[model samples]
Target: MDPMHRMEQLVTELNQHNYQYYTMDQPQISDKEYDLLYDELVTLEQESGMVLPDSPTQRVGGELLKGFTPHRHLSSLWSLDKAQNIEQLRNWNTRVLKLVNDYNTKNPDNPLPEPGYVIELKFDGLTLNLTYTNGELVQASTRGNGTVGEGILAQVRTIKSVPLKIPYTGGTIEVQGEGIMNLSVLNRYNETAAEPLKNARNAAAGALRNLNPKTTAERRLNAYFYNVGYSDDIQFANHQEMMDFLRENRFKVNPSITYFREFDDVMEQLAAIQESRGQLDYLIDGAVIKITDLRTREALGYTDKFPRWAVAYKFEAEETTTVLNSVVWNVGRTGKVTPLARVEPVELAGVTVQNCTLNNVGDIERKNLKFALGTRVFIRRSNDVIPEILGKVTEESDGEEIVFPEQCPACGFPLEQRGAHLFCNNKLACKPQTVARISHFASRDAMDIETFSEKTAIQLYDELNVREPADLYTLQFDDLVKLERFGEKKANNLIAALEQSKDRDLASFLYSLGIPNTGKSTTRMLADHYRDLHAIMNATAEELVELPDVGGIVAESIVTFFADPFTQAAIEKMLNLGVKAQAPEAPAAVVEDSFFSGKTVVLTGTLHQLTREEATQRLEALGAKVSGSVSKKTDLVIAGEKAGSKLTKAHDLGIPTIEDEDELVRLLNQQG
Candidate 1:
């Protein structure tokens, strides 16, 4: 077979599997099988230089969205003409056949017979127009007026299912697709949301519009390319060919699409989509039917509102009813409060849901929900964790009205409202807050006290009057042995772990401080600036602002934490109790003299040559900052045996990979 044709076949196969894997979480091929095909496609693409849009190589996400910009689409993305029933669909088919018949009568050479129609699921999602410049995804936009849209390149970059770059086709092209929020994603998001989205479409739109690309990426949205909105170098003979073209380029086109010469076949396909809609990850409100022949569609051009060649067949709403029992409130680790609806256990989309989130007090009030416990509420579930109460059937109920509490359930701290969010004011004194802080302090990312657990912290709190991080260093073996289940060995282990934590890295020490707004990464940045703990403690908010990613709020948080009398006293007591704060290790050399200098290197898998701590220290000593994962900023990856996705991701970003610790040592020494 010709290389181009082979490439096309390979593209279709790989993209189908990608859709099954990324979007559907069901891979048709094994990892080895997929890798073999992928390697073959890469080789073929290098040889031919004509990569299809649907190639699986495109899904390596890299670009970071800064903000949405104004973009003028190459072609107008028209709204489809609508049809309600089989009778209306038949009428449209009749009109299309009549147009084809007339065109055949007028032109002698290209006389047309009855045209076939292409049918695909009309995904109920945000319309996104993706523009490619020589196969690289340059911009993604929302359909504003068909001609112009807001470019959502940043937000789109975070969507894992979409390809960042495809094999080069000759010129610019615009692939129109739908950005769909999975029903499951929306349901999960709503559990902690201040204002829950009504449905999948709204949720998708919200994610796309989000200014922070990181948040958008967290939403795990999927996209399906359905049409070629514009193309400068490529032209399709028909809609089916266009679908074929999209697949060849590695774009995720709808798998259920079909071409039917007869009107009855089209109806069957539509019915099949409707029947299996419940099983789909994405939401679809209708079926789209279009004249397969591109020339015929052109002749039957546009109406004022929608395309005359295509029609949308909308489905009836999938709604049902349930009972609202009681509402429960949950406090998160961050102390933010949210409300949940404890409903009568009912099955929805095959899962029995007993509770659904009411979001917040504001959400409940805005919706005018008076459906107290035992009220016959109109509940509807759409692939959600909990069914939503559509509205109340009755105006009144015998149950008491749900009200927001003034005090925290776990601790007697007064609840304070900051905009829509509610927080426990007594941060250090609160039980949940203390447990959360201590647990975070001893976490693997902080002091790395693996033997210490939250349950153990609570036990210590109950018996030993352990109040803060400083109190942890003051624990005696006699005190531990007095607690339930704590033997001599357990007590010794706890003490040993605490001793080990005393000499933790400067970054870890900073992170474990339990300072508000300071996380693992932020602590690392702070350590990079101030090598000594004393220097950092003395720094003002103005000085903190000079560091990378440190905003006014974060600066203030740092200054305020160190300035606090209680915090200062706690640190003094901890230092006296053998909790020594280690200073930052000296770098091997300055950036100009060292190969490893100012580089972000990731260490993965098991190393026989050097321990993880030894390797990290060696690299840091050479001015290289070691990170846990791969990103665009990663300079190199030192992989040992069984190195996982971090190594793969480094390769995808075109970063260098080194095996064993010898090469790393050689590079550092040679450069130095």
Candidate 2:
């Protein structure tokens, strides 16, 4: 075959496979197979001294440029207004409705239809603007200052999902989308990486903004096209039509786009998406809600900075950058010494994060943060967890070194390094460790000893030498009454609470033991599986690893915790002091013939008679799958007072609803 002809055929075939694998999530060929063809094409291009402009091999990246050139966007990329809460979203909707109504009253003949909405995921990545002229990709840049941006055509071309040449050849057009580094890709990269990238957002943004195109290609980034900001030969009637056009031209459009006729339904879907945010492969900080009709959007027009027709409903931010001020080593209940970084006060996920966890010395080294003090670092807080310092801003650090402690801060014991962590083996002597263990044992999730506080633990430890959880069961009323702020009533109440905690279930008792590497879920699973405390204590690491979500580390931790002589003596002492440690009865089988059996049910708003939690439990008892939002798949909706978007959506979708309190009560009673 002629080299040119074969090259064309190879480019077409390889590009098709790339589209199928990356954009469509379906791979028709294996990686080895794809590589053989790619290598052949590379050889042919080199031999022939000719390369096609649209060749898949172009994504390999070219020479490093000195600097980026300024590229003025054909049409300004406007920012969307943000809504932090549902009320803010509702207010934006009200304003959009008023604008449409006002326009309709002015122009009666060609008035816009009732305003509908299109929902898209607000991707947490760098915004990219690509311009194509005569069907060929000519330029790509960031969404800088809305109008002008730094040109990054070479960097954008390296993204295999981006189309090199489009079928539309009538005129020039500019498409807008997000350039993202998928979470899975980031993980894989970090596994072999010497200095790991902090987050996906920063990885994508930094790669694109880099002067070296090879660095961008090495990240193996991806793009998802969403809008045609400027088009000379085409016009879209609505968002759906524009999306269809993008799809037809081989653009990588995200499949999660949905159209809704009612604004309330949009809100419901946004809430639903937010609840399942973890399921996505990429990071999405929010959802974008836009007017579906082009006419309505045009009528609403733009503000000084944002478009009035669209708003981004921002979810709680999970990640942000902050400066690390200092590092403090603290002893945990297990006598493990961990580094806690005190960062510059920054707002993250609605909380002021001043302190972040560094995990251990191994993590600090792996993240290239051994000398990251007094430098900017990316901090992350998710699901209300304590913030974690991911890494430094740059691979090479100019900051001061974070010195690992040679001795325990509290007990002044020589620290021992054990698997990336420092430990103070003086468990009985360390005051902080002992105090933490006692407090954790009496916590609400553990023994549920009411009116107990950390302050109480401190006082007991300082005055009465309450060293271990077993000591709590041995405490006398006279001892407590002699402590500061412990009146007769308070002392009596403490004794009564301690006595009541003796009957706690085996799961709670196990959690209160402060077993290493075990959480509530793991303890609960162990309790359910064994049904006896002795069985769990005697189980080997090999046997424990068979349980769900249990790994080698957790299994070994559990076995080691039980093997200790001190732990065995503590358990025996507690048992002798009237601690029952009873296991719960096996759960009853789910009712298969109830009204809510095998159904998807949604509960919305405030139930005057029963709390939402109580209603959810009742529904689940009848074998219903409780969901956060309403959709066509929803079998029934229990709408209470002030039920807003979810109830409205259920009604719109023609799903059955129980709005009356009496009807809801009757159904729940019937199930029982």
Candidate 3:
């Protein structure tokens, strides 16, 4: 069969199966068969250089959104207070009991007794609230800030189990639940997903919160209600009654709901839940214990951030024991060297963790870590954060002794200790440092050179002597094809991509320089301040620090980077190869400054025609302050597709909003 034909067949077949499983709750193909097809399609897409947007392999939240409407929550969704261990939980119980005692003492005529607790599994997923009116599903929203949320009603309609219309028409009803991915679904999805969702929480969050409803529909997300947030017509005596009411309505409620009269009983149930957690279809980071009586919950009231009525008992991080094979230092693009543990692969939280972070030399010494060649070690995964070594499993050491390297591994140079970080200081001499710099320079977030994978980066350096980003621009087609696995078609595509990257904007070019601590957003801020590459290169530390987000350390690094002779030569070389960054035009005198001027504005989701950089420039040009977050100080917020937590936050704060990029431009023109 022709490759493109097979790719189309696979995409069609996969989409059908995904729809059946996720949307329809009926899968025709087995998990094994789906994986085979999905993997083949991805390989073909990569080889053919024709990755379809709708392909199953391409669904990790895209450029945030190009707009979002606010959904006001019917009932306030209060965050739970957390207790990390049993001792902390006991302390919380004491405090709660004392609060009740004090209340009873004050009102002896109508004294209240100890409240019974309802124990439920705390699902590691995005919280969703669904509302039904007259037996018909009316609205759905995320737990944005508890009071108001971004309405994801369209995406909510995709969940198979969530009834569009409930059987019992008990007036206006609001159900609260978690949008979680089944462990089985997560495993299958990871096998072929372009970028794996990491865990159930992220999978659910990414699916429901994404700008694309079709993507959410394809996640097969499971929703299990825990409580009724609000009900205008139906009222329950206790939390258990609410659960019963939901189940009676054919609404999916967590079956694990249990009532406990004593604190000890709650603790016992929490232990049991922890022991049997592996049997469940989703991940639970903690167990929620809430007061069973609704009246008691109201009486207990809420703190500033959390409810006094309930507490979440956090589970310990998932960990596994493995032998530490060796410890090696890895050189980053900034030339900072950090110790990396090479451990024997051990499965922790369903993923095999072979390498874990040792943090820094101070962390290593403080923890009394000795990464002896054959020592048993403990590795842990908390939430979805990087796997970390949590001290040694045993004190005994049998193999090679752990020793800090005096010289750089890639280039023989004396390692310089600066604060906590060890630097190579080799500059042009370090092969790994140079290669990593080139790789970072060509990365998608930087120059967006899609063809420049780490493997390809190494091949360019070793095979073709392409040491720097500039060297890539000078590569000949004949020279590339001679290298193993570099087909004429692949080489031509890579060369074309490289040629196109030369015309990238100033921010991208600045970010591609691999300046330490100066990320994409920071680079844009610098670009806006300086306006051009030449101006940025000549900037002093004092001038660099004056820009937004540019701290002292970042300023020093930028200044030092440009001061280096090799860095100067590299930029000059790239410029000669037609790497263009058009200098910003002088600002026209403002005829009349609008309300947007001198205001802090936030943008969320993806923008159309305008990248975040482009939006930042246009907004800054109007004398508006573009902030990454939404706060009380924020004057306005522009929402785009799949606007997540930030957009909800903006609504909750009652800030002025712009619907889209066109509206924002109009505002700058003082027309809106």
Compare the candidates by TM-score and give the number of the best one. Answer: 2
What's the lDDT for all of these models? Answer: 0.77, 0.88, 0.77
Per-model TM against the reference = 0.52, 0.69, 0.52
True-vs-predicted CA distance for residue 465, candidate 2, Å? 1.6
lDDT leaderboard ranking: 2, 3, 1
Instruction: Please state the error at residue 580 of candidate 2 in Å.
Output: 2.3
Better of 2 and 3 by TM-score: 2
Candidate 2 yields a Cα-based lDDT of: 0.88
lDDT, residue 449, candidate 1: 81
Tell how far residue 3 is off in model 3, in angstroms.
Answer: 87
Summing lDDT over every window of 10 consecutive residues in candidate 1, give the lowest-scoring window.
56-65
Candidate 1 global lDDT: 0.77
Report the lDDT tens digits of candidate 3 across residue range 487-581: 99988999899888887888889988888777777887777667878888899998877777788999999999899888899899989999996
Q: Give the residue spans of candidate 1 off by over 4 A.
A: 1-196, 202-324, 330-401, 590-672
